[model samples]
Target: MYTALLHQYQLVMSSREAVFNYLDTLKPEDLLKPVASFNNESIGSLMIHSADTYTSWLVNFARQESRPFYTADNYKDLASIRATFEQINLIVNDFLNHFKDVLDAPLTLPKKEGMELTLSPMQLFTHVITHEFHHKGQIMNMSRQLGYTPVDTDVIRF
Candidate 1:
C-alpha cells in the first residue's frame, strides 16, 4: 500500500547522502562561513536546520518526545554536520519502519508561538523530504558562493 512513498523516501535519503559526501570534502572555515546570499546563514547551519526539522516533525512531534535542538554552533565543520545527520538518519529509519500502519493517521504538529497545524503522518513525512531539499538548495548555492563544488543531489541522479 505504501510502496510509492517508501520509494520516494529512499530516493530522497540517497540524495541527501550524496550531499553529505560532498560536504565532507569542504574546508572547515567554508562550512561555517556565512554566505551573504543565505542571509548570513552558514552552509552547516542550513544542513543542521533541515535535519532538525526532520527530527522535530518525525520524532518529537510524532512520538511526543522531547529532543534537544541544535544550532549553527553545533556544526562547525562537515564532520560534525555529518555525524549529526547520521543520527538523524537512524531516527528516520525507525520512523519509517514503524509508521506503516499509522501513515494516514492524524497528527498535530506544533508551531511557534503555541500555534499548531493538524495533518496526517503521511503529509508530515512528505513535508520533511521536500523541506530537506529546499534547504539543501541553499546549501548548494552557498557552497558555490564559497568557491566549492557541490554534489548533484537530484532524485534523478539516484
Candidate 2:
C-alpha cells in the first residue's frame, strides 16, 4: 500500500507541524511582520503561499477542480493557516486515493497557449512537497531576520 511513500509524506507533515509549532511561539504581530528583502512578504504569507501551492496543484490541476487560491490577507494567523492545511490534508488524501493505482503514469494537462504539460502523480506530489520545503527554508530565514531562531524543520530528525 505504498508504505514508503506514505511514511515519507507523514514525516513531511511532522516537520511541517514543527514549523507551525515554532510559529505558534511568535506573537501575531511578529508573524505578520514583513521582511523587506523578501518583497515584504511575512511568515504568514509564505505559509499561505505554500498551502496555495498544494491546493493549486493537487486539487485544481490534478483533480480538475476549481478552488480559490488563498492570499496572505486571507490568513494572517497560525490558527487560520493551520485550518487551511487541514483542508489541504483532505485534498491530498483524496488525490492519493484517486491515483494510488497510477501514481507512476503520466497525466497530461492542457496549457493556455495551446501547449500541454505531462507529469506523473508521483512527480506532482514530489513537486508540491519539495516546494513546501523550499518555502519552509524561506520561512526559517525570514524568522531569523525577524529576530526569531528557527527549529529543525527537516524530514529526518537526526
Candidate 3:
C-alpha cells in the first residue's frame, strides 16, 4: 500500500509540474483572460486557489492543527499567484520526502461550524493530493474552454 501510494504521489507531482509548465508557456495576458465559467474565475485565480488549498492542507498536516482551509483574497494579480505556487510547491516537496515518518502523526482539522476532528497523517496527505488533483482537472477544463490547448495529464500519458 505504501509503495503504491508513493508511486501515485510521484505521478501526481509529475502531472502537476507538467501542467505548470504548460501554463507557463502562456503569455501574461493569456493567463489573465477571463474564462466563461460561472464563478468568474480567471486562469490565474484558479491556479492560485489550487496552490493555496494544497499548501494549507500540508501545513495543517505538519502542525497537526485544527483549522479550516486557507482562502486567498485580494490576490487579483499574477505576481501573487506565482508566489503562492512557489510556496506551496516547496512545502509539498518537503512533506513528500518525510511523509513516511510523518504517517503516524496525529492531525486535527476544523469543521464548518468550528468543531475539530482528528486524522492520521496518511489521511491528511491523501486529502492534500487528491484535492489538488480534483481542482487541477477543473483548471484543465477551463484551459480547454478558453481555447488554450490543454496538456495531456492522464497517468498513462505521463
What lDDT does the true structure give each of the candidates? 0.82, 0.87, 0.69
In model 2, state the lDDT of residue 25. 89
Model 2 misplaced regions, further than 4 Å: none
Sorted on lDDT, highest at the top, how do the candidates line up? 2, 1, 3
RMSD of each: 2.2, 1.3, 3.9
Residues 22-117 of candidate 1 have per-residue lDDT tens digits of 887888678888888778988888888988998898888887788888876569777778788888878877887678788888887676699997
Which pairs in model 2 have colliding backbones? none
lDDT of 3 by residue, 1-158 (tens): 45666688778778877776777776666666777672878777777766666656666546644445434542455566656666666776666666666676676666458787777767877787788778778878887887778888755674
Q: Which sequence of candidate numbers ranks them by TM-score, best first?
A: 2, 1, 3
Candidate 2 per-residue lDDT, tens place, 42-91, comes to 88988899899989888888888899998765677789889989988888
lDDT of 2 at 115: 90
Q: Mark the regions of model 3 whose C-alpha exceeds 4 Å error after superposition.
A: 1-7, 61-83, 96-99, 102-106, 109-114
lDDT of 3 at 51: 69
Residue 102 error, candidate 1, Å: 1.9
Leading candidate by lDDT: 2
